[model samples]
Target: MQFMKFRKIFSVALAGALLLTSTSLFGEGNVADAAVISSIPNTTRTLKSYDNSFLSVTGYASLSGGVKDRSSYVGTSYYRTVKTSREFLQALLDAKSGSVKVIEIAANLNLGWKELNLSSTEIQKYNFVAKYEDPTNGYTNPTLQANGVSKINVSDTNGLTIFSTSGSTIKHAELKLQSSANDIVIRNLNFDEMWQWDDVGNHKEVGWTFIKVNGANNVWIDHCKFAIGADGMVDIENGSSGLTFSWCKFGLEANTNPASDSAIYKSITYMEQKYTSNQLASTSLYYKMRKAGATPNQIMAYSAYHSKCHLVGSGDKDYVNYVDSNGKDYKDGNQRLRITLAYNQYSNVGQRVPMIRQGVGHMINCYIDDTTHMNLENSVSSFKANSTSLARGMNARNGASIAADTCVYNGVTEPIVGTELQGQDTSNMDPQWANLFKNAYNRNLIVNSQVTNANGTYTGSSWDNNGVNLFTKGFVWYNKSTLNKWAWSSSIVGAANMSKTKPPTTPFTFQYNYTEKLPYSYNAVPLNDVVQTVKQYSGASKVTLSAKDWLKTVYSTSSTPTTGSSVNVGSYYRIKNVNSGKYLSAPTDASGTKLVQTADKTQATSLWRIVAGDTGYVNLVAQVGSASKVIDIPGASTDNGVQLQIWGGTAGADWQQFKLKDNGDGTFGILTMISGGTQGLDVNAKSTAEGASVIQYNYAASANQKWVFEFVK
Candidate 1:
C-alpha cells in the first residue's frame, strides 16, 4: 500500500512553431533552422533543430572551424567540407576547455583508425580479453596481435557534448566513456560497424559497444541511430546514474551476420533446461558448491559447459555490480543506477532490448518490433526443440527494477513467435538479486497482436500474461494493485504512436559518395520527430513542464480516481456510513456478530476485502482472524430492516452478495442481494450516533443508505 503511493510528478508540452533562416550545402537550402527548447526545470528537456545552436555556446565550436585545423586533415575529394573520423576523435580527447565543450560533427566520418591500436599490456589493463577460447567454435580469445582495436576513451571529462551536425553520421567506432565522466551529452549520431573479425572471420567481441557508459553520471544519449555492431548498440552499466536514452533507434543492418544455428540451438537448449526442467540447477548448484568450499576454477568449468552460454549482441553484464566500498553486498537501500529509457525504437536486433541488471530503469513509450533469432538457418528447427516458444525482448535480471510503461512489443511472425518479457531471479546467490519489480510501478505491457502458429493458425492460447509472469516469478507481487494495473493497461491500443518520422532530404548529402552498392544502408529518421513522439507518450507527459504550468492543470495526487466507483478486486477498504460517521466493524475471532457501526479504528477488524462476485456484485469479507468470513444476512432475510452479521461460510450466497452502485459523488450505495436487490444496506433508523446498527432496508437514496469506501492497507 505504501508503494502504491508513488506517482509521477512531471509533465511536458509542445512549444509553438518558430521561423528560422536555412543554410545551404552544395546548392541545397531552405531547411528549418530555428531551434525549439522545451524547458522542464530540474527535469529532462528536449532541444530540436538542425544546427547545434540550441545547445550551450560556451566552450563550443563547429568541427570545421575553431575546434580543429581543417586544412591539415585530408578530407574526402567528393565532400571536402566533411571532417575525417580521426580528426573528430583527436579534437574530442584533446579538448581541455575546463568547461562544457561541444563539438558538432560535420560529415559521415569513417572511424577506422589503425594508428591508435592498443598494446597487449594496455589490452589486458582494460580486461578486454575472453578468458577461455573454444577451438571448434569460432570463439577465439582476444590477443593484441590477432585483433584490431580502435576506441576513443572519454576519461575524466565533465560537461562535454559530441552531437552530430544535422544529417551526419559517425560510422565504425566505439565511444567509450571512462569512469568519472559526468554531465556528458551525445546525441544525433549514427554509429555503424564498430566491429572486428578474427582469423577465421568470426566477429571479435572486444570494442563492439557503440556507446559504453562506464561509471558515469548525468549522461544523455538521445536521437541517435545504432546498427550493425558486433555487440550492444548502447550499454550503460558500472554505477551510471541519471542517464537518459530518448528517441533513439537501435535497428539491424541490411546484411548483418546472423547467429550461428548450431550455437543458438545449443544455447536455447541450455536455457530451457536450466529454467524449466532443472530449475536453474547450474547457477544454484554452483553457488551451493561454492558455499561448500569449491574452488573458483571448478565452478567456472561447470558453468562453462553446463550453464547457458552468453549470447553476443544481447546486453551483457560485465560492468554491473552490486557491491559497496567495503566489498559488502548491496541491499534494497543501496543507491541504484537510475536510468530512463524513453521513446526509443528497436527493430530486428538480437535479445536484451535491453538486458537489464541492478538498476532502476524507467522504460516508457518504447516500440520494440521484429525481434527474431539471428540464426535463421536453424531458427525454426531450434525453436521447435524447446517446449515453449522463444521471442526476443526485454530481459531483466539481478534484482533490476524496471517500470515498463506504454511499451509496444511486436513479435516476429516467422519461425516462432517469442515471448515479449523474459526474467529470472538470481537474488539468492547475492542479496542484491532480491526482487526484480520491487520498485516497479504503473507497468503496462502491450502486445501489438495475438501470437499465432507459424502457418497463421491461432494457437488457442495467448502471451498476454507473459509480462506478469516475468516480473512476479520467484517473488511476491509487492503492491497488489500492480497486477490490477497490468490487467487494465495491457492492450494493443497504442501502435500509431510508434510511426516513423520523415527526415529532411533536400539539404542533406552523403559525405562518402558511393557508386558500388554496399551490404547495408542506414534507415535515417528525423531527430525532431523522434523527440516529439517520445514527449507525447512518456511518463513525464502526464504533468505540465513548469510549476506555473502544472498549477494551471487540475492534477490529482491521489492514485484512485475521485469519480470512479469501480473497485480494484484485491484492494483493502474501510466502509463508513454517512449518517453514523463510523465504520462497519466486526468482532475478533467470532463466527458471527451483528455488524455494528463503531468509531473508526486502525485495527484489523475495521478492514474488509472487496471480493469480486458474479454479475458485478461483491462480497465484503472482514479482515479479522484470517479475514475469510463474509458479511451475511442471517436466515437469508428478504424482509426490510433485517440486521447484518458476519458469517464464516460459502461466499456468493444471496445473503453474502451486495451490488455497490456509484452515487457519482465519491460515495456508493450498497444494494443487498435479498429480495432481488430491492433493499439497500442502511444505518438503523437513520441514526447519526456512533453505535448505529446496519440493516437491509428498502432503498430511499437517503444519507443512511450511502457509504464511502476509503482505501487502506
Candidate 2:
C-alpha cells in the first residue's frame, strides 16, 4: 500500500468561538450593546430606554410653539406631525428647552426657505441667531448688524434663510431619540435630500448631515437612509464617543444641480491648506466616491482642529482629488510647509469626495457596496471614525504619517479581504443612481445583495480578470487575484514585511472566510473505474496538484493547484517488491490483514509492476481500513517491468501513486506534504465478497489522493 500527499489549510470557521482572553490592551469596554427600537410611534419616548444607549432625540409627534411661549413642547404621541429643519433648529435653540433628554429628533422636519437673505459671510448668509422672546432667555442671539442689516434678522423681515451655509445642502428629515448619561438611541426617521437643486437632471453640491453629535458617548446610527446629497450624507463630529453608522444607504442623487464649482475646488484646497499648517497631528484624509448622476464628481475637506489626520483615498477616479494652483497658499502663508497630497484614483478618471473623515473613524462589520465611482481618502477630511474602521468598498487609500500625500487605492476584490474597501456589483459600470440621495449612498449594498452570480463574481474587479487580478484571503477576502497584491494587511507576515502584491494569510476581522471548516468527502467509483475516473478529474485540471510537475512546464502562480478538487480515499493499491516477492506491511487489522512483507532495497533495478483490480473486498474483510496513501515501496518503479511496484491501477492504465505515509498508529497521516512528496492515491479492494482481489493502479498526482481521514473505532 502506497500513500499520496495532501495539504490542507486550517479552516477558520472550523475553529470554534475563539475565547479571546479579555486584555487591557484590547478591552471590551468599547464594544457597545445596542437595543433595536421599533418604528412604531412614540416607542422611544421614555427616557429610561434611552439611558446608557447613547443620546437619542426623537421628534415623532408634532411640536407646538406659541409666540408668547418661546418654548416648543412635543405634542401628543398619536399625532404624526411634520417637523421641518427650521422648526428643529428652533427647538434645539429654544431657551425654555431643558437639558436635552437625548436629542429626540423625528420625522417631517422640512427645510422650507424661500428667498432668504443674510449678513454674515463668514458663518453663512442664512445664519440667524435664535433669540428668546424674554430678556432672561438662556440662549443669546449673535449680533446680526452686519453693515446695514440690523433689523433684517427675523423670519418675517428676511422671508427666511432657505439656503444658508454653503458647501453641502441638507433638507427633509425626521428622528426619534432616547438618551441616557452615556448613550443615545435614534430610531425610525428619514434623512432625505441635502440640497434641492432646480433642474431634475442636476446633482446637488450640498451634503446634509442629519445629526451631528459632538462630545457624546456610545452613539449608534443604524437602519437609516442617508440618500442623495452633495455633501456627506451623515457626518459625526469630532470628540464623539462610541458611534456606529450601520445598515445605512449612502449614494448620489440623479436629479440635482451639480455641486458648485467654487465650493468643490475650495473644499479640496481648504483641506490641503489645513494639513500644511498642522504637520504634527494632521495626515491625509481618504475620500472614496462612486460614479453617479450626470457627472460623477466628489469633494472632501479635512478639519483643522482634530489630530491624527492620516488620510488615504478610495472609490473611483471621479471620487479622487484634483490638485490645482488656484487659491492663495493661505495654509502655507508665512509658515514652513509640512504636508502634501499624494492622491490617486483606481483608473485615472472619475470624481471622488471625502464623505467620511477621521475624527475617530471606525467601520466595523459595516459594508461599503455598489459605488460606480468612489474616493476613499484616509485622512480626516470628511467621514470620521467613531468606532472601528472595518468597512467594505470598491477601493481605499491609506497614508503613513502626518503631512503625507502618499495615498494608494484599496481596490475591492474577493477571497482577499481588504481594509474594508469592497463592492457588491460585478459589472463594469457603476450601479444606476437613484432619484433620492439616500438611495444612491446605499446603492452598493442593494446592488450587491441582488447579485446571484453563481461564481460569486459580484464586484467590478471580478470580471475580465484572472487570479492575479483576484485576491483571496485564507479567511478575509480583499486581494484582487489579477493584481496579485494585498492592499491592506500583510499576508501572514507582519505589515512591515507584507507584500503589496499578495494576499495576506491573516484576516482583517474574525468573520474572514478562513473561519469556516470544510467537510471532506469523495466521489465514489468502482475499483475497476478508479484510475480512469481520476485521470479525467484530477491534478491541476481538476485537483490542487502543482501543475509544474504534472504539465512538465513552468506556469504562473495562478495556474497552480487550488482547493477545488474532490477527495478519493477508497482507491486501493498493490505494492510488490520486484526482486523480492514481498509487499509493504504494517500493524495488522482486526482481521489480521497486512501488506505482503518486503525487504528494503537501495537500487532502481528492484522496481515493482502493478495492475488494476477491485481491492475493496481485501480492505473490508481484512479489517485493514480502506485508506489512501499509506504505503512506501523499497525501491522506485521504471517504465519497464519495475519489479518493485506499489500501483493503484484503477479502470485505466497505471495512475494513482501512494505517496502519503500513514502514521505508525492505525490513523492515516496527512497527504500532500509541503516539503517533499508525491500527491496521488493508491487503490483498495472492493470488499471481502470480492476476495480482496480488486486493486486499482495510478500515479500520485492529484487532490483525489488527498484523503480526509475519519477514524472509525
Candidate 3:
C-alpha cells in the first residue's frame, strides 16, 4: 500500500517534568530558570526539491535548524525485503551513512514487550526530585532490545526508509531512535500493542514510547499509526532536531482505559492492602494524597486512561548536549526542537500533541477531536480541573514557540495550553486568558462540546504561553517573564467560554517577545476537507485499511458516519471459531453473562447482528439477550485473557465495537477497536471442549483468532 502521497506537514510552530504521587501528577511549576538555546533561528532552511510535497517529507525534517532532520535523501539503493523480527533488526544494522536503504516490511511482525534493563551490571540511579538519569555517566547509553521493541540505535546511520506493504503489523514493540542515530524514514506501518499500565497513580514509569526520538536528529516519520505508550507516543528529547510527523494518526478512542484487572487497578489494590494509612502516608505522596481526600477508587479512576500524547522535549531542564563525530558541538549553540505536524488526526487525546519545552513547530491542516472524553460528556460543557484531560490539545512550555491555526478542534477541554495565563476566574469570563491567543487560537475553529455544551461555545481560551520566564516582556512577560507554566491538572473548573470576538482587558499583548517561525512552505487544503483527508491517508494503509475509503473507493459520495444502534442494527451472522469449530454462544439471554465457545450450532444465542459503532467499527448484538445487549469486555479491559461478555445498556461503546478484520483466508478476526486494532477474541487454550472460554489476547493470527462469520438467513 504505497500511498500516492497527499498533502501534509502543517503549522505546529514548535516547540516537562517528573512528579509522582497519587494526587501530585507529573507537573511543571513556576520555578527554575527556563531552558535556553544558544540561538533561536528566525526561519528554517528551505528545501530545494519540493515536488509532490503531499505525503512527502516536508516541514523541519526536510530542512534544518529547529526541525527533526535534513531529509531522508542521500542517494538510493535497491530495497531489501524483511519478513521476520530478526531480519528486520539485521536490515537496520546493515544500514550505512551514504546511500538510502529501503526496506519493505512484508509480514505482520510481532516484537514482544519488554521492561527496562541496563544490559550492563551497572546499577542505574534516578534522581526523582531533579528529574535526571544516568548522572554518573554523563553520556547517553541505551540498550537496543530486538523483541517487542525494535529500537533504532544505529550510530551515524543516515539513510534508511522502512515502509509497509499494506499487510504488515509491527506491534508489542517500539521503534526508538537514539541521539547517536540520524537520517531515517518510517512510513505506512502500524505501531501498536505498545501502551501499558504503569505503577498506578504514580505515573513514574517513564519508558513506553512507540517512536522515541531520544536525541535522534533529521528523521522523517510519515504515514505511520501510533498508539498511546506509557510515557508518550513519540517523544523527541536530548537535543534532537530536524524531525517531521506528517499524515499520521495518533492517540486512541475516547473511552479507552485500563481494565479493572490491569496493572493500575492491581497496583492500587496492592498498595491499599499492603500499607496502612499512616504508614503509607509516611512513605510516599501517592498514598498521602489519597489519604487526604482521594479514595483508592478515585485514584484508580483518575489514573485509568492515558493523558499525555506526543511530546517534543522530555523535561524543562533537559537540553541538547551532543558532540557529533565531526567535532561539531550540538549543544553550545543548538537549534530549538523544531517539528512539523500537518494533515494528522488526533482523537480522544488528553494533551501534548507535540508539547515542546524549547522548540518551534508548524502545524498545518489537522483534525483534533477530544470531545468524546467521558468526563466531558458528563460535564455538559463544564471542564473539571482534577480530571486527567483537564489539559487537552497542543501546549507550549519553557519558552517554547508554537503556531497552530489551520486546524479544527472539537470538544477539547483546554484546546491549547502553556500559552495562556493560569488561575483566571472560575466563570471563564476573564478577558485576559493568554497574551498569545489573539494571534494563534483566534484562527483555530474550536468548540467546547458536540455532545456536552453547558456553557456557550468557546475555543480561544486555552491558547497561552507555557513557561515562566525571568526576563520581562508584556502584560505578564514584557520585562516580566512567566511566573510559571500551568499544571496539567488545571485549577479552573468551569467552561472556557470566551468568544473569538471578545477582547482581552486593557493593555493586553498578543505577540510573544521571543518566538521562532519556520520558513518551509506547504499550502493547506480547505478546512472542510481536513477531517476527511487525514482519515483517508493517515496510519499504515493495510492495518486500519481506512485509507482505501478515501484513496479510491466510495469517493466523497459518502462521509464517515457516526455509527451505532440503540439495540439492533445491521446484518446477522453466526460466528464460528476457526480452530475449535465451536460457535460463540451466549445463553440465558441475560446481561453480564460471559460469552462462551460452544459446540451447539442450533442455539439462538449463537446469532449476532452487526450494527455500526464508533465509526469504522460494528457492534455484535446478541440475538436473544437483554434489550440492547451487545458483546462487551467486563471492564472494557485491554489486557489479555479478559473474558468476553454480553452486557446491556452499553450505548454502543467503542469497547463493544469490534473491527472485523478480513483474514484474507475465508476467515475473520473480531478485533477490539480500542486496543490499537490488534488485540482480539481468542478461543481459550484452543480448547475444543463443550464450553470453552473466549477471551481477549494480542493478535497472533493463529486459528484461535480466526473465525468464520457464517451469514444467517
Candidate 4:
C-alpha cells in the first residue's frame, strides 16, 4: 500500500558506516565530495615553500625592495626582510593589485602586528593564519577588528590562544576585507594562556578576556581544546550562522605539576604585581591566587553564559554539567544561551539571536536545565528541553514572548493564549520533576512514577500517552524534531515492567510493520533471521467449507478446562478430491462457479452457493459480470447469516459483487467502485478495512456491492 507524504528523508551521510553494524539505520552522506565542478578558464598555479620568508602576504610578489613581474614561483623564507606590522599591511595592499591567488608559508615564522594600522571602525574580511613550529608561544595576536571576515582556520601544535595587550578585553578580531563571503575553520589548536589577571590597586576585576566574534556567520571550532585560565571562551554572537562547535573540548582545567610550580608561580605573581601596580583590585587577586603552586586559577566555570557555549560531539555534556565554584550547578537560560530562532530557511537560525537589540532573537533546540533564566523580549523563539531526567527552569516571567517551548517545567506560569503545553497526564504514569532532575536519566522516569508536587499532579505512562492527559500536566515529548537531531540506538532492547504474561516472553524481535495481532495460524515474528513455515490454502476455490472446520487432532489437548467450559460444535472436512456430482466444474471466467443457497435456509444464508454444475451454467447467480463476486453458502439452518465473496474479482464481474456491507456496528462504509475496467475491484472510498473497496454508486447502497475481504488460512 502507498503511504502518506509525511515520510522522512532517508539519512545518507553515515549509511555505509551504520549498515556495517546494523540493518535499521540510514544516514545522509557528504554532498560536497560528490559534487562536480566544470571548467573555468583561469591560470592555475601550485605552491611550495622554503625556510624563512621576509616577503609580505599582501597582493604582489616582492623580494626585499624590488618588485618581481613574474606570475608565480616557489621561493624561500629569506625572500624579503623581517619587518614591522606596517610593512605587512603595505605588502598586502600591493598583493591585491596583482590578483594573487594563494599564499603558503613554511617553517619558523613570527607575524608582528604591533604596528599594524587596523581600525576599530571598518569591517575587515581577511582569511590568513601563520603556522608555528612550536604549538606553544605561537601567534600572539587574538585581537582583530570585526571585519566581515567569514572564515578563519587556525592550527598550532600546542593550543590556539589569543590575549589582548590593550587594557580592554579582546572583543573582536581585526582583519582586512578580501571577500565578504568567507567561512572560518580553526582546527588542531587550543586556546591556551589566552587570559590574564589584573590586580592593580584596590579595585579587583577578572583578567583580560577574549570575546570572540560578536556576530560572525558560520563559525566552526573543531578538534580544539581550551586550557584553564581564559576569562572568556569563544563568544559567538552578532548573528553567527551555522555555528557548529564539534569535537572541541572547552572548560578543561590545567593540570597541576610540581615541576612547573616555580615557573607558574613566578608568572602568576608577576601578573598580580603588575596589575596591582596598574591599580587593579587586591580582592580579585586574592580570589584568583587562592590556590598556591602550579594549580591554575579558576578561570572557566559553569555560568549562565560560560556553560552554554555551542557544542557538538563528545563535548555536549561538558558545557552543561561542569561543576561551579560553589559546587552548585548552573545552566544558561533563554537569553544567556540562545540558539537563533529558526525560520523555515536554515539560515534563519542565526537571526534568532542576532547581536543587535530589537533584532530577531529566535533560539531553538536549547536545554534550559536548572539555572537557565528565560527573558525573551521583543522577539519570540522556540526552546526545546530534551533532558529526560532534568527539570529545566523556564523562568519566562521576565516578559519574554516564547512562541513554542517544549519539555520545559517553568514558563509563563499560567497557559497563554494560542499556546500549547503537553505532558500533564495523571493516568498510569507519574510525571514528576525530581525523577527527571538528574543527569543521564531516562524520560521514562516521569512516565513510570507519580509525583505529588505543589504545582499539581501528573499521571501517565510511557511515550504512548497523548491528548489532554499529556498536554495539561507538563511537557509534550518525543517529537519528530528531537528525533531528527539526536541519535537513537537502533539495537535498543530492553524489557518492560508491565507483566510477563501480558507482553509475551523475551527474545522479542523488532518488526517494522504495524502493531497488531496476526491472523489465525500465523504467529508474530520479530525482525530477526529466524523463520517458520506453514501451509497456505486457496480461499477462492469452489470446494470451500463453512466455519465449522474441526481440528483433525489436537497437538496437546487437555480435557480439563482452565477457567472456561468447552462445548463441541459440528464440524466438516474437505474431501481429498472433489467428485463431479458433489462439486461444480470451476470456471476460468471472472465469476468462477456460482452455487445457490438451499431453499430451506434463510435468504441471508442461502442467497448463493457453489455446488456441482455444468460449465457456463452457474447454480446461483446475482451480480452478472461484476467484480467482488458474492455467494450465499449455507451453514446450519439457523446460522444462515454467513455471506462470503470471491477475492479474484474485477469491475463489472457478476460473481464478484456485494452491497451495503455493514460491519455490524454501522460506523463505516466500504464503497467499491469499478473504474472502467473488468479486472481487480477499485475501492472508490473506504474509511476502514484494509484493502477493502470503498466505491461510489449511482443508486442506493445494496448487499450485492459491499463485501469484506477476509483471508482464511
Candidate 5:
C-alpha cells in the first residue's frame, strides 16, 4: 500500500520483489535459510547445508545489491576484498552508475585515523582540499570539524553491496549514504566506535551516527552487528526511500577494551592531541574519570552505549526522491521514507525505535528489548539518567502511516510513545501516533500479564516518569510508574506546508497515509519464533561464509580446482607465468634466493617439487645444488611488491604456503591465505624478458598472476 502512491520508479513497482522479480523472500520456511557450506575444521557454528533462502532480503530494501546477493570471484570486475580503512573507502569511490562493485571487508578497519597517507603522485597531480573526512578531495588530512564522514556514494547506480567475512568489523567510523545513492545492500558486518568524548554527554551537540541514509533509495541492511554509537544507530533523512533492516543486532556490546592499543582508547588519545584543555575536561571521558573515578582504560567499560535507535525522517517534509517510468523524478511522499524492520534486535537502547515523521513503515516480528545494560554504565552518563523512567518506543507524527504487526517489546515504557509523552506537548495527544500503540498493542499496559501473550489485556495504570522530569533528575530505569492514564488517537497534526525548519517557496500539503500494500510481499516468521530465530541467526559469523565459498555458490561449481590445477605433493614441475611465458626459477635452493621468472624451462634451477602443506595449499620446494628450500613470502610481508624467496621451513607456515585458485581455464592463480584478501604471485610489469623478477601483489586476475603447471615428476 505504501508503494501504491508511487508512480513506479522503475517498472510496475514489483509486488513480488520490491523492485525486481525474484524468488520469494522467505521461501515458505519457518527456520532461516542462513547456513553456508564450510570445510575448515572445528569452526564455530560450522555449516553443513546451505540453500540460503534467508539471504533473500525482504521489504523495501529488497532491490539492494542488484539482482544477485552472493559474492563473486576477485578477478570479476565488480568484486574485491578490502582490509584497511582506506581500501574500504576506495572501494566506495571506485563505484558509481557505470561501475558497480561488491566489497568484502576482511578486517576490523578503524576510521578514526587523523590522516590518509596519499602517495607522491596523487599529491603532485591534483590540487586537493585538505578535508580528510571527504576523500573525493584527493589527499585527505582529517580535521575534527568535518564529522570524519567516509561516504559510500553509490550515485545513480542500481546498487553497490558491501559485506564482510566472519572476522571483519567496520569499527570507529560512520557510514553515510547520500546524494542519489540507489539500490544498496550492506550486510554481515560489525560496526562500532562512533561514541566519542561528548562535552556534556547530553548527546544534543555530538552529531555522530552509525549509519545515515540520506536521499538514498532501495537500501537493505542485513545481518549486521551494530555496537554502541555516539548518537543514533541509523538516521534515514532527506527523503530516502525503500529501506529495509533485517536480522540486525543494534547495540549488542559497548567497545570497552580500554587498553592503550585499543581502538577507542587510541581515538581518545588522538582527540586529546587536537583539542583545548577546557574542551578536554568537559568530555564525557572527563565526567567518567574525574567525577565517577574511573581510569582512562576502565572509563569506557561502563558504557551502555546505545541511544536513539532510528530516526526515519529529520522533518515532516524532507520528502523522498522517486523516478517515474518516463524518467521524470519526483521528491515527494509517493517515493520517500518507506522502511521495513524484520527480525532486528535492539538491546540496551534508549529510545526512538524508529520515530517516523512522515511516509510509511512496516515492522514484522521485531525485537526491541531494553531491559539490561551491556556494560556497567555510570550514573553520570547512563542512557537513562533520571533512574525513574523506562525507554520509549515507536512514535509517528505529521499524519504518517505506520503499523507494527506481531512485534515484541521488553521492559519498554511506551509501546508507541503515548504514555511517555502524554503531558509533553505532543501536538494535541499526537492522534497520528494512536495506531503505533493500538495496532502494535502496548503489552506493558496490561497488569500482571505477559507481553508475549497475544490475548493479553491492559488494565494497568498508565506510565509516568516517577519524579524525574525531561530536564534531568538524572533519569535512570528501575523506577515505579507515576502517571495513571493512557492517551493516543488519530491526532494527526497536518499542515498545508509540512516543512518545520526549512520551508519550500510554494507550500504543498504532505501526502500522509493511514495505511499503505507493502511495496513487496514477504512471509515473516511468527511472532513467537522471532526471539529464537534472531538469536540463532543474526549478525556476523552467525551466517558463516568465506568469500571463496560464497563465490562457489554463485558459480554453482565444484569446490576443487580444474584439470592440472593441483600442484601434486612429492611431484616436480616447472611453473610458468601466463603473461610472461617464463619459468619460476632460482639460482640455488637456499635461503634468501629470490624466485625469478626465467625464460629457459629446462634449467635445473627451474624445477620445483611440491610438499604437503596446509589444507588446500602446498609448499613449493626449489631443487638446486642437491638441496631443497620451500618458497616463502619473505617475512610474510603484505606489501604490493614483496619478492618471494626460497627458505627453510619444517612446516609450511601461512607465509610459506601457496594455494592454487582455478581460473576455470587451464591456468591457475597462486595465492596465500595468510595475507588476507587475494594476495597472489605475479611477474613484475608483465615482462617476458629472461630473469624478470617475480613478486607478490593483490590478485587482479591479470595474466602475470596466472600460472601454468607443466608436470615433470
Candidate 6:
C-alpha cells in the first residue's frame, strides 16, 4: 500500500495571489467599518428576545461605589448591581437566593479602580501592610477579610447570569467557582491584573487565577478578555463539564511583567536545595513560605516541585476515578471534563494554550499569533532537561484528548520543542492510555511573519488590522474528505518547519461560493461560510453581543456534521445499518462465517473498534472474546459481489482495511482498500431482512450502503 506524500508549500507569489483572489471575492472593505457593522443587530427583533436564547447573555447592573469602601453585606435588592470586586463576590454568593438571577455589571467600569488609581508608593504600602490569605479549598461560608470582604463562594448555585454590558473591566480579583457551581454565564468582561502580591512585592508567588472552575458544571465564559494573571488565566479542573469559552482573548497586557519569571526562579532554587539537602518537602509548604514573605535563601531550602505554574490550564487536578454521589466510581464514564474553545485569539501567552489533563478539548478556528514568551528561556527549567521548549499551542497529557481544526499560528521559532499539537503518555501505565494521543486531530495553517509590537501590547491599530485581515483573508476551512486527505497526505511536522511545507492549492481556497454583498459593504463575499463568519468576530473589540448572536445562529443552522471523514481511530463503536436498525455481526470468530446484520444485542460479535492501518486505511476489529479477528474479504477477491467475513487480523493486510467516506449527513460509506474506493460494503440486494449477506458492490448513494457507528462501551 502506498502511503500519502508530504504536502508542499506555496511560493510567496502564489500565496499572495491566492490571498488577493480571496480578498476580491470577499469584498475588500475597511476593518473599522466592519467593526461598526458588527455592533448593529442584523435582525429587528427586540433585545429581550435573546435574553435566555444563548448560553451567554449580557446586561448586569453596576454597583454605586468603587472597589474600596464597598459593602460586602449587600441585600438581595442590591444584588443586581456590582460596583466593587467585593460586591461582585457577594452577588455571586447570593446567586442562590433567587430562582433565576441576572446580575448586570456596569460597562466601562473598573472593580480595582482604588488600587489601580493609587500611586506606585501607595500600592507598595498597601501590599506591605495587607495580610495574605488563601481561600479555603471546598465549600465554606464567606470569611471577612482585612479589606472588609468575604471569601467569594458560588457553590450549589444554579440559573445564574453575571455579565458586563459592554467594555467592562474587572481588575485585580480572582473569580472562584467551586463545589458544583452550575449553570453560570460570564461574558464581555476584561479580567486584568488579577494577581496577589507577596508581602515583599512579588505578585507571582500566590495563586490568583482569574477564573477557576473546580467541580462545576454548565459554565460558559464568552467574549471576555484575560490578561496578566499570577497563575492560569482560566483553570478548569475536578470533573467540570459542559464548559465553553467562545470568542475570547488570552494574552499579556503591553509592557507587563510575567508571573512565570517568579515561578521559574522558585522552581530552580527549590530543585537545587532539594538535591543538596536530600530532604523532600511538601510543595504546599513552599507556597506558604512564599506567601509568608520568605527570603530567597529560605525559599531555596525547598525543591523545585511546582514548575509548570503561571500558564493556562496549569495545576489541572485529575478527573479520573471520581466517585459520584452513589459511591460509584466513574473511572471510565462521566469523569472527564469537556471543553469547547471556539473562535478565540491567543497572543504572547505562555505555554498551555491549553494543556489538558484527563479530559477532552475541541479548539476550532483559534488564532495563535506569537509564542516568544513561551520559549525555553521562559518555560519551566526542569522541562528543558529533556526537550528544548515546554511550549505547546494545544496539548493533551496523561490520557487527555484534543481535536483542533482551522487554527492559524504565526511567528513561532522553536526547533527542538514539543508537538504544536501534542499527546504524551510517559508512564505507559495503561494500554488504552498509550493510544490516547492518537485521538488528537489537528488541521492548522502556519504563516511566517515578523509581526511584533515594541511595547508588547496587542491593542494598537496595527495589531488589530493584522489580526482582522488574517482572519478575513488568509484562513481556509476544510470539509471532512478534504481534511482527511490533508491529514493522510501531510506528515505531522513541528510548527517551526510548517511554514516551509506546502499543501495542495485547491484545499486552501474557501469552500463556499460568493453571491451576496459583504455585510458591511457593497462588495460581494461568500455567504454561508461558517468558519470565515466566525473568524470575522474573534477579537476582543469585534466580539459584541450582536456578533455572538449572529455566530450562534450560523452555528445552529449550519449543516456541517461534527464528525470528519476519518473514523475515530481509537474509539469502540457498534456499526449499525442505516436502512435496517440491526448491527453488522460475526456469528463466530471463524474465518469464513458470512457477515450478517443481526438484532442489537450486548455481545462482542456486534461491537467493533476502528484501528489505524497502513496508508490511511482502518481495520475494523471484532470484539469477540480473546479473538484477534477483523472484517475481511474472502480469498482476497476484488470482485464486485465478493462477500465479507471475519478472519484473523493480519498486521498489514490490505483486504481487511477500509476507508470510511463521510457522507456529511451523519453516515459513513465503507470502501474496501482492495477495491480502492471503486466499491463499497453493501447489504446484499438492498434487502432489509435479518441475516442478509453483506457484500462489496459498485458505489452508490443508497441507504443500504450507509452505516452509522454508534458509540458503545
lDDT tens digits, residue span 1-713, model 2: 22221101011112422332211110212221121211111112121110111111111101111001111222322112223444445433331223232223323332423212222561252343321121121111111111111111212110011111001222333121111112333322344433221111112222223444332334433333344333234332322334443323344222123334322233334433443465313222221211111112233221111111112211222121222356222111100101111111112111221222211121111122322222232332333341112222222222100110111122222222223222322243334211111111110001001111112322222211232222221112244331222111111113333232242433322111222221111112222222222222211112111111111111122222222111122222223322223333333322222233333322221122221112111111111333222223223332222212232222211233322332212122222211123322222321212112212234332222222222111
| Model 1 ranges with Cα > 4 A deviation | 1-82, 96-100, 113-147, 195-207, 253-334, 371-390, 412-424, 427-482, 485-713
| lDDT assessment of candidate 6 | 0.46
- Highest TM-score scorer: 5
Worst 10 residues of 4 by lDDT: 529-538
lDDT of each: 0.44, 0.23, 0.52, 0.22, 0.54, 0.46
Name model 4 segments beyond 4 Å from true. Answer: 1-181, 198-211, 258-267, 271-713
**How many pairs of residues collide in each model?**
5, 230, 57, 111, 18, 10
Off by over 4 Å in 3: 1-53, 64-77, 97-100, 113-152, 255-304, 315-327, 331-334, 374-388, 419-455, 459-517, 542-713
lDDT per residue, candidate 1, 30-126, as tens digits? 2222222111111222233211111111111111121222111122221122276545644554443343255556566655333334357644543
Number of the candidate with higher lDDT, 5 or 6:
5
Q: After superposing candidate 6, which stretches have Cα over 4 Å from the reference? A: 1-79, 85-87, 107-151, 195-204, 253-319, 324-335, 371-391, 413-536, 539-713
In candidate 6 the C-alpha lDDT for residue 27 amounts to 28
Q: Model 6 over residues 350-465: C-alpha lDDT tens digits?
A: 35666665455555446655544434223434323222323235544433434443344443322112222223223433443333333333332111111222212111111124
lDDT of 2: 0.23
> lDDT per residue, candidate 4, 1-713, as tens digits?
00010011011111211211111111222111111111101112111111011011111101122122211221322122213333333334334343221121111122313222245431143224211121122211222111111112221111111111100111122221121212333322333333322232121123222224433333333334443232334443322333433223333212223123222333454544544465434354333333222123221111111222222111111112223456543221111222222111010011111121111122212211122222221111211111011222111111111222111212212111111111222232223311221111111111111112224322222122232322123334334221112111111123222222243233222211112211111111111100000000100111111111110001112332211111111101111001111111112224324232121221222222222111111222222233123332222111212223333322233333222122222111222212211122122232223223222333223332223222111
Model 6 residue 313 lDDT score: 30
TM-score of 5: 0.53
lDDT of 5 by residue, 470-504 (tens): 11111222223322322211222243333333433
- RMSD (Cα, Å) of model 4: 34.3
